[model samples]
Target: MSTTWITRAETAADIPTVHTINAAAFETGAEADLVDALRTDPSWIPGLSIVATDRHDRPIGHALLTRCHIGTVPALCLAPVAVLPEYQKTGAGSAAIHTALRSAADLGEHFVVVLGHPAYYPRFGFTRASTHGIGLTIEVPDEALMALTLDPEHPLPAGIVHYAAPFGI
Candidate 1:
């Protein structure tokens, strides 16, 4: 595992390598396929797909934030975060996630939704979404679906989350 903190956007050359990393990091191919499809979808938000690299700038992890909706309100979705098996727990995934969120904040994005492990995301300031009146169109465990108010001034949006075409949501 590498201790490097560098994170950057995925280039054309990195896409296939990223797909392999995602497929290997997870038990299923869904996430790997999502990454590939999102690249061509109209919903693909440039600069929002990120990869964490080692000292040589070789990608070792990925974290993607794409356009999604909470009711009629625009929001970012964090999904398909994957780290190479060899780099798991090395902070590479976390670094990529943190960087993507921070860049979103700087771009003036206010809200983000995530369907992820209940234990992992809260460390990044995510909270139970229902407390903010946020609900999903699909049935999901209350804790597994979370919302984060990236900008304290803008409260969390309330309603269903509709992901992009690539997500099959």
Candidate 2:
């Protein structure tokens, strides 16, 4: 029961464990299936998928970033963050997300968008996407759609987010 989590880029061996974590964290397996689909999609960015491991070095949480666009400008889409049911509220999910975002930044990715819980994403520097003229094709709560700029020099672009094909958005 340690609070510390080891985060890293997901490896091929971790796929099954990541899928299991996603399936168990959500009420349905759609998120898990989406992850699998994204893996083979052209939008897949290597080293953007992250995992948080327990003391035993077993992956208990996951986060993924994939290529997307803001209008025609390249960006990233963060979705399907998942943690094991027993590990929820223990910061595993947060750790995985932070690592994923950091990894993206290290790879020179500048902008990221996430459609998720307002409260949760804001902690990671995500602000209302609408404020920047960012939106989705489909309707969603204003607060749920947020964006972040990894580099202050490059402001978040304003436009409709074009997510990967797996997202079906």
The most accurate candidate by TM-score is 2
Clash pairs, model 1 backbone: none
lDDT values of the candidates?
0.90, 0.95
Candidate 1 segments whose C-alpha is farther than 4 A from its true place: none
Candidate 2 residue 38 C-alpha distance from true site, Å: 0.2
* Residue 54 CA displacement from its true place in model 2, Å: 0.6
Q: How far is candidate 2 from the true structure (C-alpha RMSD, Å)?
A: 0.6
Give me the overall lDDT of model 2. 0.95
- Put down candidate 1 lDDT per residue, 99-127, tens digits, no spaces: 99998898889999999999999999999
Q: Which ten residues in a row have the lowest lDDT in candidate 1?
A: 1-10
Q: Residue 3 error for model 2, in Å?
A: 0.7
Error of 1 at 5 (Å): 2.1
